[model samples]
Target: MMTTPIPKTMHAWRKHRGNMEAVWEEIPVPSAPPTGFLVKLIASGVCRSDHNLLTNEKQPSWFQQQFTLGHEGCGTIIEVGDCVPSNCGFKIGDVIALLSVPGCGQDDCPECSRDLPQLCQTGYHSGIGQDGFYAPYATIDVRGAVKVPQGVTPSQAAVATDAVTTAYHAIHRRGEIKENETVFLFGLGGLGFNALQLIRAIGARVIVSDIKQENMDEAKKLGVPEQDLVPVGRSVRKFVEEKGLVGKIDTVADFAGTQETFEDAQYIVRQAGKMLCVGTLNHKNTVHMKIGIRKRLSIIFSYGGQTQDLAKALELIQQGVLNPQVEDGKLYDFPAVLKALEAGNIKGRIALLQG
Candidate 1:
């Protein structure tokens, strides 16, 4: 099969003025930034956050209008910029996943100096605070790209950068979910599903909860047992109590920060139990210090893909240890993808395919 030549203009999903669904447009193919590379995106994962953006809810004021809305993108380099090394371990056709962090703009901020660009005081973010990869090509800092391992597919690697890596960091680093411990996951969305796998991978017994029956069934199908999967509408604290696990759970990871979940997190965890909030839920989650103080509870908010965490997740994907259970994922070209995402019926992931 002959590969098509790069086009001068490419299809992109852009959110125009005001808050609205992303529309397909023949937009200029972005050029490589001064110190970055232009990647020909092979696949990009549609996240739940993308659903929110499409509805014009939870968009940061700084994002403005007319931007792409996917952070989980995997592709290969097609154009290189000036400052990046020509042989910086990335070749013209090497498949890679772009880490979600936006490149720092040569800022003299303290966080940037400390090698923490994600926390740069200037508040930059990819696919949200800036243009992202929902098209054929995306510009990224060469340093922000991690090459996908040989055994990982572009579709799997696309979600790996955020969903998988977020789970790995939350379970292993933040919550310290140890081997032989019990973990309670309070959500069955993409992030929660991956968290279940990661917790299982770490040799922990996991109990997953979701209000949607389909989500509950999917979690069980993804290796969580029927006995362990709890439907969301019921009282979680009562479930923990009836199961005789009031003080037995070592870690509770809440992807859904609902009022009930937070209350349940404190109630279900044992003394000194850790609670990991992997995704933003309900906008502002405020905890009463008095309630947590008595239990010695620890709370942490996990975000982004830490480099080392991403590497380990890639290793798991390569080894078939952790893989997303992508059911009903639609594979589309850029233009069709924009329409599907706007319609808002996609489940699992909507993977955009590039030549």
Candidate 2:
């Protein structure tokens, strides 16, 4: 059990000016969070999705000017509120993964009715639609916490909470790709690389693409063949004709959701092929209607994963099948990490550790 006394105040990265920025601020330590527990965060991920939330001109109408920023987190519970019963399975000092989305775990909510509480419309969306774990200490609903099995480090658990879970949702839950089918993966950066491994684990052949050469090189090191890596800037139609895989690519998973990425991938997917979209930025709904109608192409968009998806991701993590490469030199200071993230200077998915 944790023996350390809780601090009365902690440092946090708060969104100050309603723009693509957050500044470090001294905040009151949270306590007595209803149905949730106060946690001491070990680490959190600085994701492109976090960047997407920061860049959007329109902040959620209810967002506080000084709210904490972060969705991917791994923490140890320091104080469990009364609402979190012993049978709820969480307690003080237990390590847990934070669910990026909010959920009340109530039976009547639409997302809960469907057993998809990650899309919980009525509760905290930790770090995205609500106060997240950018702070050293934060509060989270007990239902939103996923137990980190023994042997997972805080950094790895932090990444797994969102990156691996989201990728699992994209590949296994949403894409439903079959064995031996050819899958085209766009954007092998942060989340794409994780999706690449999950797809391989399912026995599907993967064709990788990315806007960054560094990421392609990383995927190559992960066993993606040099020839199978398509440059996203190239015309998809031309690549299809040249590669002679026209109508053979079964699915196109777009982790890069720019207009260019979507438009280019639209042409690469086979007739009746599925295009699974998981990116949070640059979402252009410019579908090619006539062509899509004729081809019977299926397009699916997935947000964060459900609780079951987290379980599946954790299972993979336990089996040592899903460790995405972390960029060198972990950042302990939140402000410096935010600066690097805003510049898009960080090469891959990054972890932010407590100072």
Candidate 3:
């Protein structure tokens, strides 16, 4: 296999144990694991969750005290490990997108055996409180790497690993949204905007509600009729009532998990309607049991997407069926980019490129 000179150390943006902000420091480059590859990162996408990682005091059990912070990554393989299967098709020069959390694909593993690898507790979670692709170099297991398609750029491929794939998984797998369904979509941020396109692609009618006028306008430009957009600053409940849409919505997909949006979802969706929860703008949201019981709503929460979802999302992007709105920046711009993301100043998503 072709090889490039491996560097001894590279700069990475990491979340320190007590620091409220991310710290950039030089760290030793990692070697490929027995069943993984050492990757030279080309692009890494900044997510709103990155802000949570920086400031949130509580973390999952597997979260490291200090780790690099970037979950969405795309790169070229620089070193292949000995245990990487010969027939798996990955090579030193191949470009691939990394799955942040690829569950152990073991028969004895509960989550993976049930085909929910994204929820696997035993697996390594790249970037989510784990050493990840914020640096020039990182390592990824074979199961977490998906080859980049011909038409997708490195920026697109990077965001596709999470932003697009998560939306795709929620809409298709969890929501099971159909062409005949009328969906009430909440929020038009990174994942929500991508979810809008995915819903549109499925021939579903989507009525979108977002606090940002720019986000709503972007939705309109994506073929959402003006009538389908909730007026900016208007109460979502009031908008639903005004449109005479109460109990008419087949599914309420809440990609902005704010308290208000969660309540609005319960009020608007039809009886027995499905509620697909994908975002967590507010970590804890209340579900009114009386309303839920009376309406018989099905509340479904979705997390990260599987490798197949990423592959399918890439295919859609390649086919021009899904255009992930993203801006490019240098890897060092992570702090500023994340701040802008938290302030809701960024439109869609931002991908940081390696300098």
- Among the numbered candidates, top lDDT falls to 3
Query: What TM value does model 1 have?
Result: 0.86
**Residue 341 CA displacement from its true place in model 3, Å:** 2.4
Instruction: Put down candidate 2 lDDT per residue, 190-218, tens digits, no spaces.
Output: 78888999998898989887777878778
Question: What's the TM for model 3?
Answer: 0.94
Model 1, span 200-308: residue lDDT tens: 8888899988878888877777788877877557778878888888889988899888877887788788888888887666777668687689989888877665666
All candidates: TM-score: 0.86, 0.90, 0.94
Ranking by lDDT: 3, 2, 1
Pick by lDDT: 1 or 2, better one: 2
Give the clash count for each candidate: 1, 0, 0
lDDT of each: 0.76, 0.78, 0.92
Q: Which residues of candidate 1, in runs, are more than 4 Å off?
A: 1-5, 54-65, 102-108, 113-116, 121-124, 231-234, 284-288, 327-345
- Residue pairs clashing in model 2 are none
lDDT digits (tens) for residues 285-336 of candidate 3: 8899998999999999998899999999999999999999999988998999
